[model samples]
Target: MRGLLFSSSKASSPSNSSTQSPARTPVSTPHHRTFSASIQEEDLLYAEQVIRRWDLDSPFYTKLDSLFTGDRREARQFVKSVKNLQSAMHFFVSESASSEKLIHAQKLMQVAIKRLEKEFYQILSANRDVLDSESVSNRSSRARSSVSNSDSDEDDRISTWGTSVSDGERATVSEMVMADLKSIADCMISSGYGKECARVYKILRKSIVDETIYNLGVKKYSLNQINKMDWETIEPKIKTWLHAEKIAVKSLFSGERILCDYVFSSSEKIRESCFSEICKERAVTLFEFPELVAKSKKSMERMFRSLDMYTAILEHWPEIEMIFSFKSTTAVCKQAVASYVKLGDAVRAMLTGFESTMQKETLKTPVHGGGIHPLTRYVMNYLVFLSGYSEAVSDILADGPLQVHSPLPESYFSSMTSDDSSSISGRFAWLVLVLLCKIDAGAELYKDVAQSHLFLVNNLNYVVSKVRNSKLRLLIGEDWVAKHEQKVKQYCWGKLSFKFNEAYRKHSTWIISDRKLRDEIKISLSRKISPAYRTLYERYRGYFQGVDSVVRYAPDDLGNYLSDLFHDAGASGSTHSSSSSRYLSRGR
Candidate 1:
């Protein structure tokens, strides 16, 4: 009766329609004519036959129902059957069929399945907690069983649920995830969260297997495609894609965290091997996650800090080499270097020492006095010099220069002319000039510049005080003390020396508050530059007047000082814009 109900309805619907709407004017015209509901009934009858033939009360149907209800046991079975169905669909989804009608039918089937999946997910979500707990318990139990029954076929059966999905189904799943990611990406773009969306995209990218999808999205549709997507229609799919991404990322972090804890907590070679393996795994596809690199670096730092609690690990493992290879390590090193360069001498020294200690250095060299880590130092200097050049050039280009001042002094005054002067002798004259020019050249020269500068000053003051204090100890006959009287005289005679607190305190006051000092500084710097700069209009002289095969400004050695200077300037900063600004300045 259920399958044949349409046979009786077809003969009865037309007569009832005409009589039922008597209050309305019925037209005999074809457009207004009523049709029998029998065709609709027949169509429903046909669909019910396929559905009922599958037997909704069967064990398979009950399992599917439980799957939709979030039972892990049932879900596993459901997935196996779904995988079989997907293999069957591959002839439709992935391969061209012989008949167009069959192709259309296949598409209808796919749509129906997707709709079913949507309904299933909705039911699962409504009972998410129950499903989540079941999934965790099931997963844990499976993991234990896998270890216990390594050779058993049951383990294979369980593993095959996700891993045994047909290639076609896996591809289809990837396609589905990609499609959903695209929708979420579009939503993100339209909602004015493009940057955050990009971050999320980076995190989700490696989860999807098809690189071709990303390539197509980026190259063909571009970011504009996101705005054109139907988010309301695709939102559930997006959530599924996001869920997959979360699962993948969480898995990666779990492995990373476990290894990190083991490597840091124990000195055992096996544990270190495990940790190294984990780090390598994280790095294997790291390029796909550019946005997560920043956060990962922070996480690694915390991880490394925990390692201190286990000193035996430090003694046994080559952690320095291992850590540096981590993406997080490089990022942290970059941040630390920036902080170090701008920090006060004391803090900078401390940080520098820490950095050096972390290194697996083969050679020993002094790192103080701007010579710390020749490669790093060179990078810093080049960047700073380039910045100064940029500032000088910008000033030159800004306006008509009617007046100019003298070059910077060859020798800066270490002592004040007046005894009561309240300034610091060490104004970081060269460094300050370099920094000012860098700032004027439109570079964010220092992130925490002021604080770092002050710290350096305090550190220098501390060192100088320590030296003075040691001098006082000489009066008490300490063997460690050098000849105090001669040392005092020599330091006093030195033009770089200050009259203790009097000279520096005065200079510090003036340098801190006086605008004229900056102007004077600018003037002094301009004047002290090479004489060639002042003679820009007239340069007719040749240096080979005596018939020697020589060049002007050429040194006996081959290296160009100016070129080296510029090269060093470029090394100070990583960003191209910042490096470019460095070369436009002259004095600094």
Candidate 2:
């Protein structure tokens, strides 16, 4: 059963005029009015009662428990169900919250948002479908049609589906969605669910379409028609669709592994319907669909890790390359970590327990055939160690001291030493060392061995050499490298010099545009907490500061001197390498 929301008032009251005549009797003074208003509380218990009653026997509630249940398959089924229910729940709660019942409106919003995030656990679960379906679905619709249609489609049908809209049309749609989301967000904030509104709004802003017109590359688009569009009508449908999308995705993570597997076994159908036909433009970005497919795969794997089901996911890993790609899902992860931190030490402690159970010796075992093997055991272990103490991974890692691996048995490097083996030891060692340095800020902890310094220098050199070679090889290996090159390569230690150079050029603009963020970057860079991290921090900060300082502090002639500063930062590599090269340099 559903509940009815409060209706708007139709009647209007007389307005007060600045010049008051003696028609009205004298009332309480301003001081008395303030005192009375101070004690007021907006109650929503009645609305809450309605929400509770309507959602009591709802399948979403049942799915919620099942999604969290130990049975992975059941859990995923429940997640899917709950996701579908999320939109309905959001609307029901939001619509039902009377304006007068402010606190209750806020409470319902919080509840709905919590439910929205119920799929995080399932995101990492090892279902095969998670990885497989994404790539398979993204293929031509003819190839993907079995789940939705016959492979032999007529030419007219193809023409109808693939209507060629120019980039301008897509931009307009993106703008429409973005505008609608912003309006809904404003409404939510006004209604007392500011926090939830921000969360939902941020996700929509990032995942669907970036709201920044400059970033969206819609340079020529006109905002003149903004008033012409029916923002009111578009806003409600967009909100409804967004709620539906979140709920549907969340519900997919529920149910038993087998149940989710069976349900989404028809990935082709879902993708063809939701993606191929609807959001064809987005299908080009592998990161988007891959994550969703991975979620599906994870749902199934949560229940059937031992079965052949995970094989499909394993095979699809390359197609969904962000795991190793430079796309850097770090920002998303940072948000998650930040959210957890806000929950306090008790919640942090519980996460530690959960982490241990998820990785407790069993999931690490390798499968015989291809499957979703955990690639992050060491990282996860490190996270667990830190989680126990209630600390952020970045805080502990970013620009921290390097930690030494306890002496490994000689066998650890034996495979890599073999003729056929790739020398992955150095790369893995570099990764661990980088993480440690960032996590701990390396401090004065490993000053004796100078491991942090040496590690940075060597990796920086290696990455630089690679980038240079890649630039040279661009002609010959251009095709291969174009497909595989990581965007992060530019920020890697070797490229810090270049990044700094780039930042220095733009330093002044940032200061004028966003001064505070510039200051934070400067602090992070100047602190010497992390040499490698400093490159980015400094670039961001320096450009911000450099620009502002040049404008405010430097005269036109001195501007060249500031430009020289940018040049110096970019060229510091020679001096830096000369000093640090002694630690690990192989004698010429």
Candidate 3:
């Protein structure tokens, strides 16, 4: 495009308007007509040598096939001769418009371009291994020979990659061959045959790109087909896409961008158009896979996979933005963002559904011994697993509305900063609270008030333990754990005192309960009481002041007294009642 606009066809003429014409007539009306008349006076001396080398009957075409299979050193000379022909065409085009030399130059320009086209295809096909994007991009700046005037400002013709031979013989033969391709491409483009060069380039490069991606295991699928597939079937495809997306961005698309820019450096439009054409569909294929997966059936099991796809694209977003930055190829980027945003919405939707499911839990049976409930364990552990992708989860939650119901302890909501509502901590905390509230509503399943309170303790303790020990600790902070834990201890003390008073009052005069049964009850009660008793004694030691007997029993003494609890029917109940009353009154 930069060089004097030569004809697109082999037989270009001033009258042929088929080619894109320059703003100025290539054969400018000379300010001095005699200046043009003088053009024929001198350059004709080397016209024979200049045009004959590429006279269409030259030996180059017959031997072009041999470069792939045999001695290929002449390939460099072939490119040089083409460049020389381009220079001569520019030379004669600048001379008298009607000069016979200019006409001969046009004919030779066609012949030279024809031979160069054959060489271009042959070099590209033959050097397929040698001209890989990695090789081309890495070694390109070293091939510095220019195909046009150094000072040409057309298209800013300002480029780092040039179209000539490598700097020296030490250059790898592959680099030399790449140089040959660049040289041929530049000459063809400058000679107004860039369309022919680009046609062959796009077909071959697109195939290689498509093949590389397919070999990486990415298959093109219609959106309808993807939508019709079940998760069990499409899940693996999502995983395959996860792997393929990284490679395609880092190696496939980026490499093509570099290679296309390098090969067509002489013309920005050709390179932009070519690169866009070559990579747009392939990139759209990669990005569209995620969008399709996002649109497919979603469930709790598929949530993480969706996040995996979201994160896979999110992590590589900048590269995708840059690689497909061309206006013609922007759909690839748009598709990527669509998939990204859709996956995020899917995750939040799944999270909302997961929360709703907890609220709808079917398991209402109270654990007979006040141990952790099934809903508490399942939902808490689910949160622990979800916390591993904290960064992604945070981004997903960043836009989420606060889902915390007001009945949740205000401490849970107040501890959050303004931004924390959309952070992983807020989302995960909301989830845990949803489970906790569900448990609170189910407490009435137990007939005994003490057992119901104890059930709350068990489930809250389980939630606290999970958050304290796992990645959830980092997400939901220590303040949350400590607050919930204090509630656990408070419930525990109330449950213990209530049970002890009930047992003592119901059986004051009773005796001779089975020894084994007595021992099991004592052991169970011991588990609750001894540690709390010891802790209280240590914490409030001497608080009873001078009345030491009001505290009467140490933790060990209490355990010893428990052994005599079901003895002889006639044993004095008054003494036991007296001490228990004194202790309970003071403790209360």
Question: Each model's number of backbone clashes?
Answer: 39, 52, 0
TM-score of each: 0.21, 0.16, 0.72
Name the top lDDT candidate: 3
In lDDT terms, how accurate is model 3? 0.69
RMSD of each: 27.8, 32.4, 8.1
- The digit string of per-residue lDDT tens for model 2 on 358-463 reads 3343332322222212323344343333323322322222223223223323432332333212122322333333333332332223433334333333333333
> By TM-score, who's the top model here?
3
Residue 490: error of model 3 in Å? Answer: 4.9
**Candidate 1: residue 476 lDDT (0-100):** 19
lDDT of 3 by residue, 505-582 (tens): 576446655667766876887888789788866653442233233344557656654654665555453355555556
Candidate 3 at residue 207, lDDT? 91
| Sliding window of 10 residues with minimal summed lDDT for model 2 | 153-162
Better of 1 and 2 by TM-score: 1
